[model samples]
Target: MAARKIHTLIVGAGQAGIAMSEHLSAVQLPHLVLEKARIAEAWRSHRWDSLVANGPAWHDRFPGLAFPDTDPDAFVAKDKVADYFEAYAAQIKAPVRCGVEVLKVERGPGGRGFRIDTTDGLYEADNVVVATGAFQKPLIPQVIPADAGFLQLHSSQYRNPDQLPDGGVLVVGAGSSGVQIADELNQAGRKVYLAVGPHDRPPRSYRGRDFVWWLGVLGKWDLQTPAAGAEHVTIAVSGAQGGRTIDFRRLAGEGITLVGRSGAYQNGHMAFADDLARNLDRGDANYLSLLREADAYIARHGLDLPPEPEAHVIIADPECVSRPVRDLDLRAAGIGTVIWAVGFERDYSWLEVDAFDAAGKPVHQRGVSKEPGIYFLGLPWQSRRGSSFIWGVWYDARHVADQIVTQGRYTAYDQSARARQAAPESAIHAAAGDPDGPYPHPHL
Candidate 1:
């Protein structure tokens, strides 16, 4: 069958895809957004029921659409976030096809464009934009024993305390997701064990203003490098009850047992690292660094702002920090549930292109792929540290759309020589699905 040709074909109808569609529409470009599931599927299905956006509503607005003035400072709930995307799509009349999953994307005939094989049908596009945001796949360490007799769940599958078994729960990785889930489980009368990892514990509010406001004012949000923004660790804060800080020490005091990083699980025994104090110290250092930078920025700008508030005192138990459990028997400890909040993996296996790096990550500068007529949006550090967030998509999307408009339509062979010269054989092999390649399927 003949493929339906399009000027630009965008994959994933999440925030990034929707934002890209809006920009393309503004420029009067012909484009269509194809989503594997419904629009905002991740927010609607993947997130927990009680999950609220880590950022406030005011900071979550996309281009040409602002959150209703009802509660700009409020943290939008999962359902509300999905609704916002739906409403934005309606308002913009975005051309989005939900439930259309792209199975594979390869060089089109004669390398003139891309041939996209989707569940519905084939699509030929002069240009293609991958707008699938970060966090494509849930990452569970391989060290976790599959036979470990416990109800294991990743943060993506965890919904509420009631959904878990009626027993103690061990929440691994003390990032935003881990801490929040631990807090919720503890509040629901479940004995909670939090495996603390290296994480930032920034205050929810500083100097009578939300921390987000400080980040924006201090130019933290504008940081181009991921290193400067401390993108490694998730921001530990909550939007529940307006906004509140998430302190490990506070959770520990509230009867939540804190352990060190997880190591391995074998023979019904889970091993944990004994670097809790060191990790906490590192997090404290990062927090101080950010505060100092913010303070310096305020002084440099000579902005009239209130003095920084005193740091909150969180008393930690020495026993909790010193006690080392090299191996823990889950069944003996009565821990029936294990929640892995470790991290996420990005997958671009469907994209058959030579514009990937040794790590299987796309090689792009400010959202424009090295390969002509291809682009990526909504990736962390794609252009700025905020690139993966809702508020950040607009900037990257606009840049990508502009690139498409400037480059016009062309075949892949036009730049095949340059791509071959620039990209390594390993990247090409990985993209072409060489079984012996460094990056195999299901991971990338």
Candidate 2:
């Protein structure tokens, strides 16, 4: 079959793609969004049944749509988030084709456009935008022993405690997911063990306001830094408790055993590093740094806000301290399940282009790729610290849409000028059907 031609071809149907589509439609540009699965597939299938968005509903709104009348501070559940994306797409009349898994994307013939091969069919486009997001693949450690006599699952695959056998649960990695899952398992009457790592534990609320509000007021989301490394920390917050901090010390007090970072699994035993205390201290320091920055920003702006509230104290038990376990016998300890919540990585192997750095990451300037007519969206630190968040994608998408429209107009004008130059004056006059010669419009 002949390949379909599109003006703008957008990949993915999540917040990024939807935002881009909305912007493109606003500018009266024709575009098509292709999704490998349903809209918001990650939020629908990868998250746990009870999982909720990390941010409040009010803060998670994308361009041209806001959350329905509800508790603004409430964390939206996964199913509701998925539904919101679906409703937003329908509301905007986004031209999205679901279940169209893209196999490869490369330069088209003669280097005039992009060639996209997908499950649906071959598609050629003048402009291509990648909105697949940074967290495309789960990062599981290569050192995890395959023969270990226990069920191991990534946090993405874990739904609830009932999925595991009746035994102690070992949660490797103490980021938000790891800590939250450990807390859930502990509450479910199972012995839960959390492996401590370097993390940032920010307070959920301060001065009678949610931390997210403070971030907005202080313009934290606008700050742009380098991309996060593999060991990037997370805010220790829980959606279950109305977006409150999941205090590790409180979890330890509730009888959840805390161990250091997992080193390796060998001979039915797991080795742990001896840096739990240091990790905890680093987390505390990071929280303090954030608070200091907020306070300084408030003072600098001379805003008459409420006085700072007294700091909440978290008491960590000695058992949860830096105790190095050279070897932890899983069988003897009766631990039957291991949950790896390390993190996620992006895989761009399907993108056949020379627009990546040595690190295999796309080379882009504020969502605009180095390659002409190619762009990226929904990446952490792509344009700002919040670029990866739902609220932030709108800015990047709008910018990309403007670039596409401007470039498209310029290309059209260039082609029209070339055509006029190639045609004879008599032919041009005949084509114009006017006594005066046909001159291009100034704007064109």
Q: Which candidate has the highest TM-score of all?
A: 2
Per-residue alpha-carbon lDDT of candidate 2 for residues 379-430, written as tens digits (9 for 90 to 100): 8888877887888998889988888877876787687668978989987667
lDDT of each: 0.82, 0.83
> Candidate 1's residue-wise lDDT over 172-232, tens digit each?
9887788889998999999988898777777787656688887787777888886654567
The predictions' CA RMSDs to the true structure, in order, are 9.9, 3.3
lDDT of candidate 2 at residue 245, scale 0 to 100: 67
Residue pairs with backbone atoms closer than 3 Å in model 2 (clashes): none
Q: Provide TM-scores for the models.
A: 0.88, 0.91
lDDT over C-alpha atoms for residue 436 of model 2: 37
The collision pairs in model 1 are 111-412, 112-411, 347-444, 348-444
